[model samples]
Target: MYRRIRFFLTSVLFLCVATAFCNDKENPDAIIGTWLNATGKGHIQIYKQGNKYFGKLVWLKEPNDEQGNPKVDSKNPNASLKTKPLIGATILRDFVFDDDEWNSGRIYDPQNGKDYKCFLRLKDSKTLLVRGYVGVSLLGRTETWTRIN
Candidate 1:
């Protein structure tokens, strides 16, 4: 009886550890691939920077430029930012996953050279909803991102 009880406890413990390991492997915020902005207005590529996530403009349908060059955020009002180009500007930055959502992040709009409070939520394995807000969460726009993979 003693041996049987010991074996049963050991089996249960092993099962619990395996379950926990499996759960950790199933990360929903594994947005570590190329994604396209399905908003029809522009295209973005999301990539990882160290332990966080960021996005940059890979392509734009209606690029805001006069000479067909990629437009910078001239309307930023910040002299330093207004001169930066749009192509390689870091639009999404410091996105960390919390539970099921990414919060307290910032998104830069190259067209306006403005950074807004950004949060992202995975609608599924392929779809991500990215929101950019000013002061309040309610005052934000949600854009759907489709995984390129």
Candidate 2:
């Protein structure tokens, strides 16, 4: 009887450890990948840094402007940063997963050189809903980004 009880407790402990190991192996965030923006003009690679998520533009449909010069963040509010190229710029930053979405992030629009409060939600494995709001969520705009992979 003593051996049987010891064996049973050991088996349960092994199972609990195995379950935790498996959970650690499984990724909690399904949003890590390359995603194409709604306009189909740019591709951003979403990656995890620490406990947060960030996205940066990797490719652009039109890399160069009409003058054949590489597109830049010309409209950036900061005159010192206006010369920075837009192709590899970090457009999304500091997103923390909360509830069913990634919240407390900011998305920058290189076109107008403005930043908006952003939240991200995965509609499906292949679709992501990116919302950028000014004051409230209802006052924002949502864009659908399709996963590349």
Candidate 3:
């Protein structure tokens, strides 16, 4: 009876450890690569900055103005921000992963050069759901980003 009880306890302990390991969040290493805006409105590249992650605009479907001049984000009310357009802009900033989601981050919209609070979650191994919000998270937009690999 003593030997049977000991074996049962050992088996239970091993199962607990195995379950924890298997249910762990997606590996951070899996996120360390280029991803594209599969919606085709724009392209983004995510990279590491120290221990944080950031994403930048690499391409756009509409890269120019109606007159064929380089487009600018004229809608930005900030005088210092209105002059820059969709090129060479850092759109995603200060993203960190925890608890199976990326929180406490911001995404910049090159279309208006405005920054919004952002969060990211993996919908699948190859798809990410990027949420950008202005005030409350209840009022936000989610975009789908596809892994480039």
Candidate 4:
């Protein structure tokens, strides 16, 4: 009877520990938040739509032109988009979460009027690593983004 009781207690303890361990794992939606870009010039807000993730420039350090007008996507390749405001523009698109990383996305560069293949991974709960590549990942650039909220 004592042996059986000990075994039962041990099993309960093991189950409790296992459950805690599993629950402590990071959620796939943990990336949803406002993040400060590496240059500290812009703030990107990441959000989910359906099952995919996207990020947009929500704020900019220099949100105005020399004439003090609201900044627009002046460098956008599409002539129509060139007049679109940059603050609400979606810069990161179509990212899908997989194996602790977000991939299969495109990152739009308003400064250069270019789009590059991109991927994102969390360095921790508060830090994100973003990579944008042209042809291959090895030829890409990585930027560190910090959570803002």
Candidate 5:
């Protein structure tokens, strides 16, 4: 009787530990990949840094201006950042994962020179929903991004 009871408890403990290990391994980095923007004009690469996630503009359909110079953050309100190149710019910042969604981030719109509160959700393995809003989320816009692969 003693051996049977001990074995049962040990089996339960092992199952609990295994379940936790498996859950932790289940795609915590699922969003780490390059995604094409909704307009099909640009690509953003999302990567994890520490416990936070960030995204940067990796490519653009038109990387150069009419003068053949690389595109820059020309519309930026900050004069110091005006000359910063659009490609490789960190457009998404400080996103934390919570319950399968990324929240508490900011998305920078270089075209309008504005920043908005943002959240990212993966609708499927290939589709990501990006929402950027001001004041309230209902007033903002959501864009669908497709996985590059």
Candidate 6:
């Protein structure tokens, strides 16, 4: 009877410890890392800030223009922002985890200076599906982003 009681107590303790280690909110940075864009044109480093997530340009395929000058957002719709450099630009913003995925985020495309409603769903530990749309999520396009490291 004493052996049975010891076994039961050990099992309960094990379960409680496991449950605490497997919580989602506790791992807010589960998806924080460097990821490559679909076309292999950019590497974005996702980071967390005050319970929200954002991504910025860390590396670029072509960092310089034809004249060997650092690249700028020349295509930006806003004339004032057109001169802003591309490196370290905040291209993703305001992401929160929800329903086993990260939702309610915005992705900014520097190529066209357009912002799209986007959400991220991890396909696995090494892959992520990023969907961007205008209105409803059903009308969006999904892009596969591979984890950089």
Q: Which residue pairs in model 3 clash with each other?
A: none
Looking at model 5, residue 148 earns an lDDT score of 99
Candidate 5, which ten residues in sequence have the lowest lDDT sum?
Answer: 19-28
Off by over 4 Å in 5: 1-26
TM-score of 1: 0.71
By lDDT rank, best first, the candidates go 4, 5, 2, 6, 3, 1
Q: Write the per-residue lDDT of candidate 1 for residues 28-99, one digit (tens) a residue.
A: 446666677766666667777777888877766666677877677687767887766666666789988778
Candidate 4, position 60, lDDT = 100
lDDT of 2 by residue, 5-45 (tens): 99999999999998766542134477889999999999999
- Candidate lDDT scores, in order, read 0.77, 0.90, 0.78, 0.93, 0.92, 0.88
- How much is 83 displaced in model 1, in angstroms? 2.9
What would the TM-scores of all predictions be? Answer: 0.71, 0.80, 0.72, 0.84, 0.82, 0.80
lDDT of 4 by residue, 1-149 (tens): 99999999999999999876654124778899999999999999999999999999999999999999999999999999999999999999999988779999999999999999999998887889999998899999999999999
Model 3 lDDT tens row, 43-138: 688888887888877777788888997777677667776778766667788988877888799987765657899998887767888899988998
- As for lDDT, the candidate ahead, 2 or 3, is 2
- Per-residue C-alpha lDDT of model 5 across residues 62-123, encoded as one tens digit per residue: 99999999999999889999999999999999998888789999999998999999999888
Q: Which numbered prediction scores highest in TM-score against the true structure?
A: 4
Clash pairs (backbone) in predicted model 2: none
Query: Cα deviation in Å at residue 5, candidate 2?
Result: 34
Clashing pairs in 6: none
Better of 4 and 5 by TM-score: 4
Total backbone clashes of candidate 1, pairs 3 or more residues apart or in separate chains: 0
After superposition of all CA atoms, the RMSD between model 1 and the true structure is 5.6
For model 4 the TM-score comes to 0.84
